[model samples]
Target chain A: MSKEMTGAEMVIQALKDQGVDHLFGYPGGAVLPIYDALFQQNHIEHILVRHEQAALHSAEGYARSSGKVGVVLVTSGPGATNAVTGLADALMDSIPLVCISGQVATHLIGNDAFQECDTVGITRPCTKHNYLVRDINDLARILHEAFYVAQNGRPGPVVVDIPKDVQFAKGTYVGRENIEHKTYKPKLVGDNDKIQQAVEMISAAKRPIFYTGGGVINSGPAASRALRELARLTGVPVTSTLMGLGAFPAANSQWLGMLGMHGTYEANMTMHDCDVMVCIGARFDDRITGRLDAFSPGSKKIHIDIDPSSINKNVKVDLPIIGDCTKVLEALITTWKSQDRHIDRDALDAWWAQIGRWRARNSLAYRQVADVIKPQQAIERLYAATKDRDVYISTEVGQHQMWAAQFFRFEEPNRWMTSGGLGTMGYGLPAAIGAQIAHPDALCIDIAGEASIQMNIQEMATAIQFNLPVKVFILNNRYMGMVRQWQELLHGGRYSHSYSEALPDFVKLSEAYGGVGIRCEKPGDLDAAIQEMINVKRPVIFDCIVDQQENCFPMIPSGRAHNEMILGDMAIDLDAAISDEGKMLV
Target chain B: MSLAQEKTERHTLSVLVDNEPGVLARVIGLFSGRGYNIDSLTVSEVSQEGHLSRITIVTTGTPMVIEQIRNQLDRLVPVHRVRDLTVEAISLERELAMVKVRGTGEARSEALRLGEAFRARVIDATTESFVFEITGKSDKIDQFALLMQPLGLVEVSRTGTVAISRGPEAM
Candidate 1:
């Protein structure tokens, strides 16, 4: 039913109709009407953020954890401009977010009026789609369309810019059920012939590996289930991109760990030597496919993805299935079940033996010195402390993020959130807050580096005000660890401004924000400190001092092949370890 | 050999997109943002009732890059369809150019003669100048412009290129 209402009221009504229960935003002069309308409503709770960037990141975390479209509201000019980074981040990582920004009055748009900037123009490249509502009649329709566009196939951020005058103008509000998109349908089912071809390749191959990515998680729980079924049924080992961490259970015997620059030895080796590579949901990003000329040279690759653009964009595949991961995996399982002949048992056994040898390297191992806590050890202890609870983890981009990916095991999809594609440093704290808001009683933590946490430290006040028990476990290494590591290896250790000099005592900072703070310097106190941080009923910043000189290992150096990874100090000489067959394949 | 080392080839892509504000900017932005080449482009509203516009873009890339271009164009939310006219079918490519020659004597007559030889029409004329409008393949327009250069060619304005498939199918 259509009813007459002011444009601002329609904004709230449209969101309510779309089932949005929360909004992350900061108020400004231009959005007064929308704020006034919001104040009148009790259905949608607004979490006021300190910075507009935090608002967007929080929405992204909420969306990633809850598997729903995250909503954000902001005012004109800088408010919209501040959201650009998060928009770009969401676009790169395929997170679904809808941002509504107030524009200057329609007449004053080009007059350089107060608090005015071209929101749609600036966000065009970063967002999946955007709209600027000139007429009040288009307001409700565009709001509903923004939500639809954000959460659909190959989901990404969408922006709707509403002029202040348009917000005040009276218009007829149309519910979502009355609106229909004519040209935005995405393909969800794969072609049967191509799926059959994929199944045939899987059954005939010996050294087969499934390289999964965020698409499996994005496809929802059903896709993860289908993936587990397919892996078990075909006896194929599985490795994932950092974004795909929890889609396949970490505890499963067939899991080969994450595959990329900082991936495990066995995972990267399997990617290089596998005869049949079934890549589902993950685009072969540059990080994943090192030295593209030498990547998986001998493999018959099959790529399954929902976006047609993702296929053949990086690594070309023999079979390209354009469909949702869940649908395609289901088809593969059914087709493989019907085939009388399966994988060659003898060749499979030999392949498993080679993988076992690679696993024996223990690429993730790092010596724990008695005097100090290694970052990896800190993450392992944190994982141990919270693994039994209803937990969601987010991370800032740094060495700590890598350690969390390597050591903190995820058993379910959506339990881990990080800025994978853009690698934004300030993503974690706000994201943890967003996740905490989504699942009120769940244990939410931001695995952060000291340098990365400082980027969005102001959000601690927001967490305290909202009563979110989000924990920020800071691995205090006193350096921009990733940059320091790179400088040491590639730039002759210049260090150049990589040090975290003039750092705030995170404990005091947390206390200043009216929250609890815990500091642990000794390795022996790590577990108890993590437990204390977890048990805190309010926002807490756990400052865990770790080894300052540690470097993330098992790294495929930039421009190097996947097979040419530099393992940790404990690893044996890899050149002598590779078999003659592996040498020939390389 | 790596796919990147392969020789690049020119391809013409016809894209149907929603005829709305900033839609063209979105299409152009994709090319510039991704570092993809755009040799020439022409766009206009094709269906008034359907609110659709057709954009014809000429780009040069390797086979893989060309495939990437098609897929990326198709991925745009406003884009309805993307058809590679160069490879999909026997297609016709044409461009419209208006050439102005500013000579009073033989150069003006020569420019007019060449324009007629290329099926050009005299759209405008003055005592000291003549403007000839011509429509043909992009190469034909290029050749006509080249010939007019020596004939005191003052200026030339050209619509880049527009193409259509030869078959009865609709893109």
Candidate 2:
């Protein structure tokens, strides 16, 4: 038996049933009824944001930090259009979210009504899945299904578009237990034969490396623990992608820093020369596998992932185990123990010697100057000051982002959140806000670049309103650092519009939003500024002015193999020397 | 095969998707948005419980472009499976075409003779015209339409290629 209620009431009740305590949204004409229903209820709290786009990003920050499915509500037309970037961002990063958009009435659809657009059509590609509910009877079930699909499988964003008429109409409220999804069960346990094959390869290989990614964190804390135990038991060096940092402890001796375009020297060299590569949860993205033909050329690969299509989509593996990361890692551990798998000790010692030679390069080494603060040093000092506290870190894209990933050490899962796949610039502030909201007592900081922080600077108001102390540590270089570096290297020094002109002083900007601001321009003031920012009881912005012309290095130029990396000290000076062909390119 | 022969080949692809609203539009949008050409398209509910639909599309492209299309289709979350029926297995493909022709005297008799020869049935008829429903491979329908052009062919409407694997395996 089901009780009759208005669609708006059903929406509120469903959220309550799903254990959702908070939602981020902005009210509009189309969602007025739902907003009215929200007004009469106190069970699910709603956080009003300045813009709909910020609402979705706040939800993303909340979801990525708390490991919960974030929810948002917005109106149709521009409200829904504004969320396209966040939806695509969440989709690319596999962040689970259920975004509910209120559309125009069913009769007004396709009729060019005011405040109406093709919400379902526009969001279809961006969202993992979406629905347009036409009948009132289908409203309750669609909302429940939206959560089911968004949180299950490889997690991603899902949208449910509700019309204005449906909000006013009556519907039967069905609980979650009554809803059923057919033909959508994902395989959670891997094949036993495939696991056995992986164990055999692991026991025999001389130079073995473990490459892990965000999927381990997505699989939960158990997988992260298993990954650490496996690396210790096998005595194999481990490397990770940008999204996989917190999934394995950075302090562990077997850790080879990050592996990719901006990866450390030892990590990239090991990936290029390994005999057996065990990829646990990370896809072989282009950044990780530089030139396809030369990527891990001599390795027998083993890949474990939940998505079947992701298995052989880019790099083919000799053995494919399709299952959750924790389940598969547990099975591998069991199989190895039961078979008494062992490797040649003498061969393993030689492999470590070779790795030690690569480590001697000290790929992250940079000259520290007395006058100006280097971006790398700023992140290093920030890490040194916050290393002992319960902290969550988020970053905006560019050189500062890479430096943050290189310098900051993460020792636990789900503690670091950044825009990895899409590389969205304005991700850090709101993500910090969301993380701070989830864990009010923890120190949450966004390691941001000067230019990227301005993209979503309006979110400072949200933090101030909520009284959440999220530190925004901006590496102020006064230019789009990554773009300038690319222009210098690839465009023959004809710098485009990468420099930020007429930029407002961040100190004044923070005060304008009623928040604390601190500026540190010299190397001597760096540590004290970070400490001051951390001690502030309100929202604070720490602007650390750094070297403007410095470039991020250990970079494998586009379409080049990993071994052909250009170190920072070896980077060519574009201004001092120009080839005869450089004139033409300019 | 020679490189020239492999440059562009007509291939039939079968895609299984969730039976939900706007899914077909999403599939068709991928083709038009990317500027990829679609020669023919047919869609119908394939599951008896009414939760899944099969969309068969016939497009011509190089091997690389076809592979990209399949990968992109698979990336869509609602899409359950995508199979290149032409390359994956030996399969039978058929198209249904209704051809209308207006003729008189000897032309009319010749039209009837050709229709019988091709095993086409006259679904509608008048004294001077007949609408023949023909079902066969795409090339066969193309040949029949070409033959009817000389006998005063008026119009033609064709359902795109629908295909399935020949063996016991279900894709």
TM score of chain A per candidate: 0.97, 0.97
lDDT of 1 by residue, A1-586 (tens): 7999999999999999999999999999888999999999899999999999999999999999999999999999999999999999999999999999999999998898988998999999999999999999998888888888888889999999999999999999999998887778899999999989898898899899999999998889899999999988988999999999999999999999999989999999999999999999999998899878889899999999999989888888899999999999998888888775478889889999999999999999888889999999999988888899999999999899999999999889999999999999999999999999999999999999999998899999899889999999999999999989876766566899999999998899999999999999999998888878877899999999999999998888776788888888845544444434333331
Task: Assign candidate 2 its CAPRI class.
Answer: acceptable
Positional deviation of residue A32's Cα in model 1 after best superposition, in angstroms: 1.1
Chain B TM-score per candidate, please: 0.96, 0.94
Per-candidate clash tally:
0, 0
**Candidate 2: residue A502 Cα off by (Å):** 0.8
Query: iRMSD per model?
Result: 1.0, 5.1
Provide the global lDDT of candidate 2 against the true structure. 0.88
Clash pairs detected, candidate 1? none
Clashing pairs in 2: none
The models' CA-based lDDT, in order, is 0.92, 0.88
